[model samples]
Target: LVSEEELARVEARLRSINQFAPVMHCTHSSVSVDQVLNIHGFDLQRALKASPELLNTSAAPTKHDARVSSVSLDQSAPRHLRTVQKGELDLDLLQEWIGELLNNSGEDIFRMKGVLAVAHAGKRFVYHAVHMTFNGCFDEPWDDEARESKLVFIGK
Candidate 1:
């Protein structure tokens, strides 16, 4: 079990990465099945009443610096699968890229997470960056799946 202060740090870390800390409650410190299921709905009213901290935090920690209503893209359609050449990427280079991204973002970049299929690497790696910090870890191999970089970053 964690105290409220510890959970606050966790929630802050998650918010840094564009993720929300899950809220679970029960009648007692030891939870029963029914109590767990009862809050499963996660209704706004119930959540607000349960945790007043939610009110203190920003509901949408994003940007609206511009009054622009809509953004027009250069390309009419989504461009998927922009291919890369063999030997184009390696573990070290990947790390450098992630580092540069985080460092350059300052704090405008809130949350980013993705999976990369690095070239010339056997096992896949999971990448996570939150609040100017980034980490990469060894993941299972592709097995029957294809090796490809599927990454997305959400920022201001």
Candidate 2:
């Protein structure tokens, strides 16, 4: 096991590399699932308290590719959470864009999560990626919810 002083030094080095990125330390036996989620910017209690209508709903489509909004937990840093919304998206184009993004700026992007409304697809495409690695699958049917694509990126 590394000493606390050594850990602090390592954390400091990482922070110097990316000041806006989250730095956390956890042992396999000590870290809870909620702690993990919080590090990734998912706050369960905050989400539970949020109104259902405020969740996953997108605004009216504009001429832009997507409406964007950003937030930063630490006032010292620039915006770290970026939300992008669109009414519909082309799956092939989206994949190409993501690939390009990872190839070009993966180091700056910490994580990305999205629920996409792909053209001609009946079910929603749900994906979450950390850095350059990605995982996605067709989730539940769109049902009554608006067929809107919402993507959130957490990055430096």
TM-score of each: 0.48, 0.49
Q: What is the per-residue lDDT of model 1 for residues 38-107, given as tens digits with 9 covering 90 to 100?
A: 5554567766676566777656555766532322222213455333332325778778777787787747
The 10-residue segment of model 1 with minimum total lDDT is: 67-76
lDDT of each: 0.63, 0.72
- Largest lDDT belongs to which candidate? 2
Q: Estimate the overall C-alpha local distance difference test score of candidate 2.
A: 0.72
- Give the TM-score (vs. native) of candidate 2: 0.49
Name the runs in model 2 displaced over 4 angstroms.
1-86
Error of 2 at 117 (Å): 0.4
